[model samples]
Structures are given as structure tokens and as C-alpha cells.
Target: MSTTKTCVRSPVPTIALCFIVALFEGLDVQSAGIAGPAIAAHFGLSSSMMGAVFSASIIGLLPGALAGGWLADRLGRKRVLIVAVMIFGVFSAATAMVWSFESLLIMRFLTGVGLGAAMPNLIALASEAVEQRSHGQAVSFMYCGLPLGGALAVLISNAGLEGSWKAVFYVGGLGPLLIVPLLCLWLPESSAYRAQKGRDHSAPTRRLRVLFQQAAARPTLLLWVSYFFTLMVLYILQNWLPSLMMSQGLVRSEVGTVQVALNLGGAIGSLLMGLLMDRWRIMALIVSMYLGTVAALAGLGFSSQFYSMVVAAFAAGFFSIGSQLVLYALAPRFYPTSIRGTGVGSALAVGRLGSICGPLVAGQMLATGSGAAMVLMAATPGIVVAAAAMLLLVAGQHRNQR
Candidate 1:
């Protein structure tokens, strides 16, 4: 697949491609959550073993993200993304036929390679597609596909679909297959990426080094800290909310409904935050973090009733998931184009570590069965307070930079 030489300018097609990519990515992620019980039942695996299976994917994501970012920078965003989509699609289907737990873990880990690689490419592509001023809106809009795709996966699985767990993977696998042809036809190479590639490679490397040094050194350290903590909370909620609700004695149908509500809230949050980001970047972040703090606390402790739980779940999804999507949108603006992929990829790779720990910690807590719920609730205040402090530091640094 040769990269497109001509710069394409249509936002609609570009956004459509991003949405499709995000849809399949979200489908693959949500499939595991939806199918966890079935997989455990079929294999008679303990919760710890199940956690390992899910973590396998995250483990693969670490390398996938780093490699995908480099590939997008070196080759082209469109090419790498198409390859990733196909890889995940094929492996997800293959996972359905795995005869044992170890086999399933290996397959999912391979699929995670594809899944992790696909996301940063989407972010980079979307960021490059639009004007700098509109970058946040563009990225946030594209990421809406994440929550929507997740919601679709849950809804489809909940609809019975022959009551087979494998159906979830089938749907997830088919999504990328459907998107690949369109991607080949419509997706365009990023102009910014090409411009960067055309530059003196050594110059770009130097610039990247400076950017990282700046980011890691003083002022930007706060941004990285906030980014890490925010993702820790967000990923934990996304990966475990359904299971947590089930632990609360909700039926599977109710779990699906709550998941849908949460995702729906995320969709709304992404759009709202994107708009807000354009006008008030720092203020918007602060407000979203505060909302996330409240929602998380509410979701963990209160909300015993079905409707109340749904509301709390929706708020949690909106604030936590929504805020992180906003952060991705805003990330590119903080760094120069020379090292944009590296910066974003590094942040995401670090966040993936947090994501990896989240499920494991939750599983261990569940196993202990003492103060488990409270401990989970405690993640909210701890993360939010840290995030708030970091953001304040970032704002102070920005003021000083000015």
C-alpha cells in the first residue's frame, strides 16, 4: 500500500475513518469485558486467572503503542493503522476457537498488539487532519467512537445474539474487516507526518530530545503527572465497572444497561469537553476532574438503587472517560510536531502501565473481600487530589512561561 502523496482536506471522510478505527478498537476492548464470565465459566478459571487473561492484552498494548507510534512516524499513519486493524480483526476471531485458557491468553495478547498500535495512530491522524486551533475538537470527536463502540458491543451482546459468547468476538472481528476496505480507499497520509519526514531527520531527533527534556524536566512534569493519574482512574473504571456492578448483585441485563449509560455519558462528555477545551483548556480540565472525583465517590459508595446507580455510573463515565479523551485532544498542542507522536506515545505507554495495574489491584481487593469497595472508592479521592494538584502546577508553569 503506497502512501497517498496528495494532501487530502475533507474533514468528513477523515473523521469517518477515525470513527471506524475507533469503533473496532472499542469493540475489541469491550468484548473481553462482556465475555469474561463466559470465558471463566468455560475454563473454570479463578478470578486471578481471569485477571491474567485480561492483563495479557494490556501487556501487549505496551509494545504495540510504542511500535505503532514509531511506525506512524516512519512509514505513514494510514498504512500502520490499516495493518493494525487487520491484525486485531483476525486475532479476535481466532480467539473464539481457543481450546484452553493459556491459548486464549496468547491470542488476546497478540490481539492487544494490534489494538494498542491502532489507537495512537488514530490520535496522530486526527490531530494532523485539522487546524491547530481545532485540534481538541477533532480529536475528541474521533474518540467519541471509543465509548460508542463499547456501548454497541455491550448492546449487541445483551441482545442475546444466539447466546454464544463467541458472538462478541465475531462482531468485534467483523468491525475491522468492514473498515479495512474503506480505510484503504479513503484514509490519507498525514501532511504533518510527511512534512516531518521530509525534514532533516537529525534535526527532528534533536527537537524530540529537547521536547522530552522540557516535558520531563520541570514545568511539564506536572502535566505528565496529571495525565498519568487521570488515566489510572479512567482505565480502572472502564475495565471494571461492569464487574463491579455485578459484585453489587446486579443482573447481567442491568449490567449491560449501566454500561450503556456510562458509555452514553462518555459520548456526551467528549463532545462537551471538546467544545470547552477550545475556549478554556485549563479551566475545563479542572472542572472535569472535579466532576470525576464526585462521580467516582458516588458510584463507589452511594447509589444502591438501580436508577441511582445508573445515574452515578453515567456521571462517572462522563467525567472520567470524557476528561481523558479531552486530555488526548489537548496533548498535541503542548508539544511541537517533531516529537508529537513520541510525546503522546510515551504518555499512553505509561498510562497503559496504570491500566495494567488497575484490574490486578481490583482483583486482589475482591479476593481479600475486606474493605474492597471502600478501597476502590479511595482510588477516586487519591487520584483526583493528585490530578488537581498537578493541573494547578501546570497552570502556574504556563503563567510563568508567559
Candidate 2:
């Protein structure tokens, strides 16, 4: 592998830039949750209304990822990415100024569009920048920024913000706006994208159509399925874990500690998973991760003691978030650079659908008097389904290889 890890000429800098962008993504995600309560109190809104506001941004992500990925292929990754940053930054700051629930929903949805657009472009740029052997390292390491960003938002909120939820949005907004100039100066466009653009003056829609061709169809469908279930379980934990834990008689303060443990484990998991992927067989690694995740979820649901729950949370993060990074690392390899943006974006858009459903299902289950443990256990069957999809994907890849 070429160790041409240089600035302006190398991917290291681009990966670093993507990591910063991922931090903004993570920061925005946590900020909404942290601010949701204060925003509700301020507006005298019910929990359902606030939940709608939260879902608005997520709803925007589906189209954002779709349109952003499509545009990145047609226009350019760097261009789309910068515009995405600006969209989120400006609208997210505007979120602080909303006078009512409707306004808040609009701003958040707009901000989500920007975030959605940024994701596949960032992944495309980073994935294309590096050697194939190092793709996992680049993507997974870049994602470490996500959990870190979440952690940063929490710290800033707890220490810096003076009971004003808008302060979180201010920090979230300012970071990306400030990064835009630096991205323009330092972030290089994907060489693969540039090459494809040079050879084909084809319209973007034409290129997108290639993904549905016979050779691509099976893998595309399976990838979308895998992404869906993968995100379903993840968002379930992210959205409902705290509430579920508190309902289980855990003290409020301890719930915060649980989040810390989970995110900290997530960071470590991303790092380790990246290293392992570069060295191990991906199939073996993925199977290990899936089984480990099932174990962790089972443990989390079954354990009643304080220490066991915390340990389970840590293990859950280690396996689930870690596996997500692995899947992301693997995603780009499924498509040539020509439609990589579209492929990744489409899969993520599907994943967002699962994200939307995760919280809703969890809420309904809980409302119906389902135990916290059972609510979590509900994800196990989905994980098994996802694992089967992955195996089918591997089998299909082998056939293609032959």
C-alpha cells in the first residue's frame, strides 16, 4: 500500500476534515436530545409535540442523503459538502430563534437536510482518498468523531451553558460555519470522482440508474436491508436506553453515567474494529460483532444490578456502534467510485427509515406495559435478520469474485 499520507496531496488531511464534520453531526444529534427538555419547558409543549420536532430533522435526513448523494455525484463532493455545512449551520442557529413548535420543526428539518447531504459526501471523499486496504481505518476512525462529538455536547451543556438550550445550538452552528473555509482550502475532491467526471459527461440520473441493473440489484437490496436493521437497533438504544433504564429504577444521575460508559465504549470500539477489519476477514469479523452484540443486548435486558447494567451498556456500545463502523467501512467497497455516493447515500437513507421507526416502536411497546428488558430484547430478532442479510451479501460477493 502506498503510504503517501501527505497534506493537500494525501487523504490524511481529508479524513481529519471528515472527522471534524462527523463531530458536528454527533454534536447536533446530542444537542437536540439535551435541548429537547428545555425547549419543551419553554414552549409548554407536550412530550408528543417535542417528539415531532425531533422527528422532523430525522425525516429531512432521508431526502437529504438521497439528494445530497445524487448531487455530489452530479455536481461535486466538495461543493455539495460545503453547501451542506452552510445549510445546517445557518438553520441550526436559527433553531435557537424559533418562537413556536412549528418554527422549531422547520429549522431542525432544514438543518437535518444539510447534515444528511454532508454524510455520504464525507464518506465518499474519505473512502476514495485512501487505499482500499485502509478504507476501514479511514471510515471507522472518522466515525470516532461522532461519539466524541456527542460527549463534547454533553460536557459543554453541563459546564458551559447556563440553562439555555440554545447555547448548544450556538456551538453546533458555529463549528461547521467556521470549518467551511478550512474545508475549501484543505479538503481535496475525490480523485475517483474527478476521473469519472472527466470520462463521462453523463447526467446524474443516468448514473444513478446503473445501481438497479441486474448485477447491482441483489447486493443493493441486501445492503439496504442490512443498513435498515443495523440502524433500527442502534437508534433504539440511542433514543430509548435512558428512558428504559430510568424506568427500571435506576437513578437519574446514574443514567447519565450509563450514557458516558456507552459512548466511551463506542469510541474504543470504533478504533479497535477499524484495526481488526484491516487485518481480519470481514465475514469473520462481522459475525463476531453480531454475536457479541446480541450477547450484550441480552445482558443489558436481563441484568438487574447496577454494575451489570453499566457493563452491559459498555459492551453494547462496543459491539453495536463498532459493528456500524464496520458496515460503513464495507459500504463503499460495494460500489465503484462512479456511483459510490449514490450507493452509500441510498443505503443510509433506507437506514434512516429504520431510525425513524426505532424510537416509535420502543415508545409504543413501553406504553403498552412491555418490560424494559423485553423492549430491548425485541431488537434481537431484527439483528438476526440483519446477520442473515450480511451472510447473503458475503455469499453474493464470492459468486461475483468467481
Candidate 3:
């Protein structure tokens, strides 16, 4: 193995800058959820219509993920990230101003495109900036901004602001706007990416096809499968857990508190897992999956016991959500720098399909009176699936080396 003597240090200022940008990106992504109730009330919308509003953004995300990766590979990560942030911010503000449902949906979809594009580039940038050994920790630390941002949204909403949910959108939109100039000034282009792009000799299509082909081999396939199911469970929890608690007669403030706890646990878990990754990569994955599975089951089976429920939620957040950060950390190491962005972005893009399905499936199941137990139980398959996939990946890696 060839190791570079670059000895890149993740400076506090640069990481802080990246965290703020990532925070804005996360807030923008979750703003719709914060604003959904008010929007529905304003428009006298049906539940189905409200669901469509939520779905539109995710629909835009699919193409955005793929396109953003390709763009970052071509134009550079910093440039694409800044542009996406600006686009999302602009559309988010536009969403706040729009009166018609159709217009709001259109703006939301556009914002999703920006939001989706931002994440992969952020991952690519963070992964490339750090030394290989510290890759997992750096990426996990960077992604901690996500759950923190979501928690911030809940806090802002709870403060009983005067302008209703529209205020959340305005704030969410302005966050990225504020960060854009700072990002341009402080965020450097990925040095590794720049070097690889300079050596590019093939058509972009050929390049992409080749990258996808490389990803089709055993370990890559296993990683993608693991990522897909993990995302499914994570997204389901993110979108439905609050509502699930609310349905069990928990007050809105308590529901928000649960979300905060979940996020806090996730942040802590990511940091811990990052450290563990360097020492026991495969063992860390197994432990995370097993913890997630147990947490899900516990949360579902003991919905009425507030403390137990919270503990279960915390465990789920700690294991499942943080595992995602671990996945992003591991992704760059799995592929060479030449296709790092593509590999990570494609995994994220495909994983997002599972994210979309998760909420929808949970919604249907909840309607059928599946209860918290069923919902929590639903998460088990995802963990088991992910664990099996990881084992396959490990086996594949050993075979490849041999």
C-alpha cells in the first residue's frame, strides 16, 4: 500500500466552516417537515396532498445525487457544493414566499436538488481533506452537523415564534445564504480530486461506466446493499418516530425532546464509532448492527414506558444513525481517489431510494394499526440485511487480497 506523506491536518477553522455549511444543508433538508403542518393548514390540504409535498423534494434528490457527483468530478467539489448550497437557499426562500401549492412543490423540488447535490460533495470534500487513517473520524464529525441541525429546527419551532412555520423556512433558507460567502472564502477545493481530474483522459460517460463497473465487484455490491437497508431504517426513524410518539399521547414538546435525545445520541455515537473504526472496523459494524436491531425491538415493544422508550430511541439513534456516518467514512477507503466521489455519491443516491420507501412503508403500516411494536420490528430486517452484507464485503475483501 502506498501512503502519502501529505500529513493533512483537519484544521478547526476549516472543519468548523464545513460543519456550518453542512448544518445549513441539513436544516434545509428538514425544513419542510417543520413547516408541513402550517402549510397544510394554510392551503386546507388533504393528508395525501401534504404527503406529496414531502415526496417531491426526495423525488428531486435522486437525480441530484447522481448529477452532483458527476459535476463535482468535472468542475471540482468546492464549486459544485457552493452552487448547490446557493440554489437550495434560494429555493427555500422562494418556498416561504409562495402562495400556491403547485408553486411551493416546484420550489421544494428544486431545493431538494440542491440539498441532494450538497451532501455527496461535502462527503467527498471531507474525505479527501483528511489523512487516510483519520478518514472515518473526520467524516463522522462532519456529518454530526446533520442531526444537530435537525435538533436545532425543533428547538426553534418550540420557541413559539410568531410567524408560524414559514419562519422556519426563512431561517433555514437564510442559513445557507449566510454560509455561501464564507464557504467560498474558506473552503478549499479537494487537492486529491484536482490531481485526479487533471489525469482524466476518457469521455465522462466512459469514465462513469468504468466507475460503476468497478463498483459492481463483490465488496462494492455488499457495501451498497448494506448502505441501502441501513438508510431505509434510518430514514424511517427520522420521519416517523416523532409522529409515533405523538400518537402515543406524548405532547409536542416531549416529542421534540425525544428527537433531541436521538440526535444527541447519534452525535456521540458517531464520534465513538469513528475511533473504533480505526481499531476494529468489522467488529464496529457488527456491534452497531446488533445494537440497532435490539434498540428497534425495544422501542417498539415498550412504547408506553417513557424512559424505556427514550432509551430505546437513544440506542437506535446511537447505533443506526451513527452507523451511516461510519458508512460514509468507510466508502472513500473502498474506492481509489479516481472514483471516490462517484462511488460515495452513487451509494448515497441508491440508499436514498430506501429512504423514500421507509417513510411510505411506515405510513401505510401505521395506518393499519401496526403500532410501535410493528414499526420497531420493521427495522430488524434492515439491520440483519446490513450485517449480512457487511460479512459478504469482508469475505470479498479477503478474496480480493488473496
Candidate 4:
């Protein structure tokens, strides 16, 4: 597609709308973790059972991302995104009304489907809406909403809501539902997607096949590896951090403080990485990011003092969440507009697998008598693998550019 026809005249409105969707997504994603303890107690759930609850949404995410991306290629980013937002919104609100463990799992799984589907569209729209040179910043800016919304979820959790854990869901659900109208009025379909739609004559199977053909195969595999390991670490932190901190001697209020710090750091890290992604040396930045992640994980493991844990949480959020944002920005560049949603979605779907594993592994480890430090340290090797995969992916992209 021609650059002029591919990109919108102004990306702000599209990116802004996508940001709103992502904000709610972040809230819903973190809501399960924020509300975990109360829900576990209310339902009398064991650690393994609670891990199942955490994995339910992620399991739904795998298919949701796959189908959502496929539909976006056929239907359109805006249409698919709207339906996704609605599905998650209704289900998230329904989460508060669940009367049993099964119902809670059902509601959360449906919410995960919506969240999964919406993410690739957000990345696709944000990247396609802007000039190629600005893709990194555009997607990063939109993605920062996720961590900021997580911060918002933390605040709501602590906001004296009569001890009702359902309050976070109500806010997370209603915000997305309310934003649908705004999206209808303001969000534009990706110009690139529109241009390619009529020309995309390949069948769905063919599109899937292309992901593994010749040069595409390596990056696709590497991206999946990077996503899987990185997300495993991230989801572990997101879902288990509060309980883990409490187990390590922090109070509820202090854990809440660390959660806020973690999220705030995520928001800042996303924007910071966005600015540097397009300008900095790729390999060096990748090294630094992963190294920081390792240090943060160690800090979270060893730090028993309240203030030290808070600092560690911030660093953890900064590098771990920030690395994911960087990956999101990079994914769009590997595929053209026609299959961009599919490519990104497939990557995200694979990442959700790690997401599912993270919480489950943490739960099992804790249930089996692993310490918080042991659980935290277990993630280091995966970080090393993710960093290596990303470096190779970047090297390939540079070679292609040459």
C-alpha cells in the first residue's frame, strides 16, 4: 500500500480511542489479582483452585486473540474492536455478580476473550494510523494506558468500598461500556486495512501458512518465544505480587502502595521505551531492559523492608511491563497491514499461554512450599531466553532493512 493511503491524516483520534479501550483492559486484567484474596476467601478456594481462576481468562485469551485477529482482517479493526470491548465490558460487570467459583471463572474467561481480541486491534490501529517512523511512540503511548489503568485499579481496590471486592469490576466494566459510544462516534478504521481488504484474496488457511513460510518462520517463532517467556514473568508478578508481598510480611496497605508504584513505573517505562525504541541501538537497549528485569526480580525476592520492596516493585513494573510494550511496537513492523492483526494476535495468543502458566506455576510452587524468593528467582532463565530471542529478531529486521 502507498504510504499516503495506508496512514491516516491524523493519528491522535484513533490512538486516543484505542488508549481508552486499553485502559479498561489493563484494569480488568489486574482486577482479578486485586480481588483475588477476597474471592479466594469468599469461595474457600485452595491455591491450585485459585490458579485455575487466574488461568481461565488467559485460556480464553488464546482463542479470543486468534479469532479476533482473523475477524479483524476480514471485518475491520474498528468493528471487531467494538464488539470485543462490549463482550469484555458486559462480562466484567457480570464478574461482580457471580455466586460461585464456576460462575466467577466463566465471567472472567469471557472477559479475557474480549481483552485478548482487543489488544492486537489496538496495536494495529495505532501503528497503521501513524507514519512508519512514529509507530513505536504511537503504540507505546496507547499501551501506557494499560499500566495506568492498572494503577487506577489499585487505587479503587484501596478506596474503602465497604470491603466489597466487586467494586473494581464495576468500575472496570462500566468504563469500557461507556466508552463504546465514544468509539462509535470518534474511532476511525485503519486506512491501511481498508486499502488491503479488497486485495487480500488469500484464504484464512493460506494466511496462517504464510506465517511459517521461508523468511517469516524464524521471526514468527522467535517472537512467540519472546512473548511466551516475557509474559510468563509479567503475569506471575501481576497476579501473585499482592499475596506474595503479604506472605513476606507486608500489610495490605503496603502491598497496595507497591502495586501502585509498580503500575506507575509501568506507565512511565512504556513511554520512555517508546521514545528510545526508534532512536536507540536495539541490541544494547534489549540487554539493558532484560538486565534491569533480572535485577528487579532479585530485589523483589530479597527485599523484606517495606520501602525496598516498593522500589523493587517499581523497577519490576518498569522493565517487565515496558519490555512487553516494546515487543508490541515491534510486532507490527514484521507484517504488512493485511495480515498485521493476525500476526500480532498470534503472537499475543502465544503470550497468553505463558500468562496462563505464570499464575498456575506460582500457585503450584507456593502450594508445594516454595518461598516467594524461589518463585521470583525461577523466572530469571526465562528472561534470558526472551532477551536472546528479541535480539535475534531485531538483527533480522535490520538485515531486511539493509
Best by lDDT: 4
Clashing pairs in 4: none
TM for every model, in the order presented, reads 0.91, 0.92, 0.91, 0.97
* Per-residue accuracy of model 2 over 270-322 as CA lDDT, tens digit each: 98999998998778888998998899999989889888999999899889889
What's the TM for model 3? 0.91
User: Which model, 2 or 3, shows the larger TM-score?
Assistant: 2
Instruction: Please give the RMSD of candidate 2 to the true structure.
Output: 3.1
Cα-lDDT of candidate 4: 0.92
Candidate 3, residues 1-402, lDDT tens digits: the string is 998787564446556777787777766766676556567678887545655676677777777887887778778888988998998888888888988989988998899888888888888888788788878777877888887787787677677888657776887888899888888887888888877876665555765576557545555677778778888887767766766776677787787777777777777777777777777756556665566656655764566877777777777778876788877787777777776667677777777787777767777776667877777787786778787777777667657768
Report lDDT (CA) for all predictions.
Answer: 0.76, 0.82, 0.75, 0.92
CA lDDT, candidate 4, residue 279: 90
Cα lDDT of candidate 3 equals 0.75
Q: What's the alpha carbon RMSD for model 4? A: 2.4
Among all windows of 10 consecutive residues in model 2, the one with the lowest summed lDDT is 154-163
- Compare the candidates by TM-score and give the number of the best one: 4
Over the stretch 325-391, how does candidate 4's per-residue lDDT look in tens digits? 9999999888878788889999999999999999999999999999999999999999999999999
lDDT (0-100) at residue 329 of candidate 3? Answer: 80
Candidate 1 residue lDDT tens string, 1-402 = 788687557877888789878977887887787778777888898777877877888887878877776666667788999999999999998888899988999999999899888888888889889998788788888998988988988887788767467887888887788889999998888878877785535443454465557444453455566666676666666666776778788898998888898888888888887777777756657666566656555665566777877887788778777777866876666666666676676666666776677777766776677342564575775476546755676576478678
lDDT of 2: 0.82
Error of 1 at 3 (Å): 30
Candidate 3 stretches greater than 4 Å from native: 1-13, 37-42, 45-47, 201-204, 212-216, 398-402
- Of the two candidates 3 and 4, the one with more favorable TM-score, higher being better, is 4
